[model samples]
Target: MPRSRMLEYDGAAWHEDCFLCSGCRKPIGSEAFVPDNRRFYCLACYEQQVAPRCSHCRKALTKGGLTYRGEVWHRDCFLCCGCGSALAGQTFTSQGERPYCVRCFSSLYAKKCAACNTPITGFGDGKYVSFEERQWHQPCFKCSRCSVSLIGSGFFPDRDQILCADCNSDD
Candidate 1:
């Protein structure tokens, strides 16, 4: 522990006070000690216990990995829940803790239009009209006869169809 007995490493003299490794409490003289979280670990402990691991593969992430929703995943291990497609660098949706692609998510959860028999996704100018607990597209809502728009206007229900006030009176 004397200055005359100090060991020189990397052009600097290291004393006995800093000679012990944090993991095994063993003397680390010239051996490399990896620093992690402000604590130094021996080579064996660093590779076995202190290294970061992927959540999906459960293996040590040797290269760069991604952290999504607080879960770590390697590039090849990040996949969609619905189609099992790769989700790396792609937009995804989550159901509970499972990740799914946009196309798969829409097909599974999108609402369909009752009048047009097509999915009524409210994207852009596609608007939905709800009447009598039934959903219809804006362009599809019309009277059965003469095909007149009945939105925000007086209309009558005839049998299994909707009719405009003028058409209902005429009939």
Candidate 2:
């Protein structure tokens, strides 16, 4: 048999790549060309070849829309700069900046116990207290059963909670 180069449409013949629809490959006559590109296509096929939707939100991202990390996530889905964790359900310290996670923010201001030299676990009046022959933050110091810092603020022999000056004023 012989090959057919003639595209038949509604009893009319058209040339290849000349008046054929770019999408459905059907014959088109004097259709409007899209801006910047002269490709011709039927109205139905033109709509079908429109821009794709976002992968993350499944929303149509038209021209001038943003695409992040090759996926289309909303601007609010970005992570925190301090810990690089996703930001959600937390108050930001900086008005215009993304907030750090609890873990990251706590580590930023937490201080080491004077006696044990471990990170303080609770709030205090910015002072250290003696407990079991060791010094700890006022709130973190505790009795064996009561686990509370002494009320009177003074030092005792071999019993004191004094932190180094360098560790006291750190931010």
TM-score of candidate 2 on Cα atoms, chains taken together: 0.30
- Give the distance in Å from residue 18's predicted Cα in candidate 1 to where it truly belongs: 5.4
The model with the greatest TM-score is 1
Per-residue alpha-carbon lDDT of model 2 for 85-110, expressed as tens digits?
A: 65544443322333455456546744
Q: Model 2 segments beyond 4 Å from truth?
A: 1-78, 91-98, 115-136, 142-148, 156-171
Candidates' C-alpha lDDT: 0.76, 0.50
TM-score of each: 0.55, 0.30
lDDT of 1 by residue, 17-115 (tens): 666677788877668777676566778877678777889888876568898889789988999988899999987777778887777766776566666
Runs in model 1 deviating more than 4 A are 1-21, 24-34, 42-44, 114-171
| Candidate 1 colliding pairs | none
TM-score of 1: 0.55
Q: Lowest lDDT 10-mer window, candidate 2?
A: 162-171
Best by lDDT: 1
